[model samples]
Target: MDPNIQGGSYDNPSQAACAHGHYGVAKLLLERGADPFSQGGRFTNALQAALFSESEAIVKLLLEKGVDPNPGNTLQVVAYYGFEAIVTLLLDDGADLNIQDKTHRNALHEAAMQGSEAIVNLLLERGTDPNIQGGAFGSALQAATYHNREAIVKLLLEKGADPNFQDVQGGLFGNALQAAALRGSGSIVKLLLEKGVDPNVQGGRYGNAITAAACNNCWWDDGREVVTRLLLDYGAILSDAP
Candidate 1:
């Protein structure tokens, strides 16, 4: 039996300490060479563990121990969860804002989907591409629209996000307008329409927003009527002749 317990469950002692916010124990483990940058765990590493522990002290200690901040979507995780302090600390510690996760979504996309206006604005201010298209919802505007995050949608639009941007990689929602219509975001739908979204533009199963609303299957009853009227107001052609 070794004094440094490293031969048990996948949960290492150092990681456990960090996750539980036991700062002194974590320091002891690191003194015993417990690999602060250990790869592959629930939180990925001690820094991530500390970050999720909601302890600024632990996070600061890990950073002092030279833990890398941008390891495998850590920044994305913080941004998605709207961990403002954690995001601010990571950014100060040199986390790469443009690092893409498994879904090819960057921090901006995650922030947008989660309706995190503060984090989204911070990312944008730090130079995230507003029109970066590759995630599950294509552009950040499309992501915000899919999740019906109207505030984020408005912010993205104001920052010059493309409304017509299509999710060619994901392919389910297509452009921001179609995605909003399918999910029944009348406000978001109205915003995109006001921004000049071509209603007849073809994409997704419904072909167009008018058809998406008329189908009455993809959307719920909550805002279906409002979206339909809004689309009609924006000059959506019901015939689908395009």
Candidate 2:
């Protein structure tokens, strides 16, 4: 039987084996000429499938078989999933930590969004800039604040993430303060404010921090109210509202 034969929900036997963490089967397929680079499945390739399967052995096998560790947001995906060992392997094999996905987010952004503190720390310690803005949240700080990842937020700030930094491309939350407001994360909002983030720095969908808080209709009745008060206390300009 041809090892590259496409079947099941995978593009090829190799992909299926890798996706299911069948290391032995994947090895056999590769040995029989299954192209590790064959692209088509939901994961785009066998190496990515192995990543989804969270199988380090299969990942190492594919890498040894000539899979490019730098492609397909490899580092970002592992960082997002908190696969610390896999992340280390990819980095060691030359995966670019600063490589942004289609959404323009680097590994730091993914780690921040997923609250993966260890990954975040690793990326930071490895020299991943905490403020390479462009993603949906503009910056890692905004992403962390939006997701209420307090520890990650603080970490990024300490590492030189600009609290007032807005993505030059313009994003949904504009700045970290506005992001916290939209998330109804009063504590994060306060943290940013205490860090000296300008509460009136407008640009996002809601324009400013107060407006973002006002527009937050979360399930918790006091969520928006709490954030609004925090924004106000920090001197969010009412004239800049919306």
Candidate 3:
């Protein structure tokens, strides 16, 4: 077998083997001196393929055989997809916990969006900054809040995620309160307000939570009113005098 010969237009033999979870075939390719570091399209290396599949076993094989785990997007992809076991293995193998993607999103931000509390905790234990802003949701806490991941949001807050964190990720609105209110997550809105997030705080697509409730036409009035009432209960004094 020609070690470098591509299986077809999309990938080489090793890449194809790894992509299909053909662990034995991949092992054979490696034994025959196939390049473990070969890149094709989105998957930059065979280790990426290994992690993309049933993982643990394949990833372990790649690591033992001396494949470069590389950097940049690898760890972030694994975290984004909620592969806890693989993430742990990669971390143990010295993958950077704070490695950012093209949008400057780290593993923590991905885990927060995915509601993968286990991975979030692992990243935090490794010193991942919860307030680090990037991607559509800005901070990891905002990501969790936007998705109504109440458990994850609370966990982040407990770990010092700023409830009043301003959005710098270019999201329509730049605060967790706006995100929660617009999405009709009344419980999440209450949680943020309880955490001392100012309901009257001005920012985002709508200037404040009151305006966010007024402008979000996606939800029915019943839902919008719930969020509006919650905000008013939190001392958000409204006026058109401005």
Highest-scoring model, lDDT: 2
Tens-digit lDDT string for candidate 3 (1-242): 58878656437877767777888988888889888877774466788777667567778788887765555587888888999888888887777777778878788988899999999988888788878777777788878977879899989998889999887557666899988887778988999998888888887777777787767465545467899899888888789312
Assess the local accuracy of residue 104 in candidate 2 as a C-alpha lDDT between 0 and 100: 88
* Pairs with backbone N, CA or C atoms under 3 Å apart (clashes), candidate 3: 167-174, 173-204
Q: Name the 10 consecutive residues with the lowest summed lDDT in model 3.
A: 214-223
lDDT of each: 0.80, 0.85, 0.80
User: Best-fitting candidate, measured by TM-score?
Assistant: 3
Instruction: Please identify model 2 stretches exceeding 4 Å from their true place.
Output: 216-220
Off by over 4 Å in 1: 1-4, 31-33
For candidate 1, the 10 contiguous residues with the lowest summed lDDT are 1-10
- Using alpha carbons, what is the TM-score of model 2? 0.90
Residue-level lDDT of model 2, residues 169-193, one tens digit each, is 7677778887788878878888888
Q: Per-residue lDDT tens digits of candidate 1, residues 3-105?
A: 2455344357777788888889888778877777776556667787886687777787788789888788888888888888889888989989889988787
Quick one: ranking by TM-score, best first?
3, 2, 1
Q: What is the lDDT of candidate 2?
A: 0.85
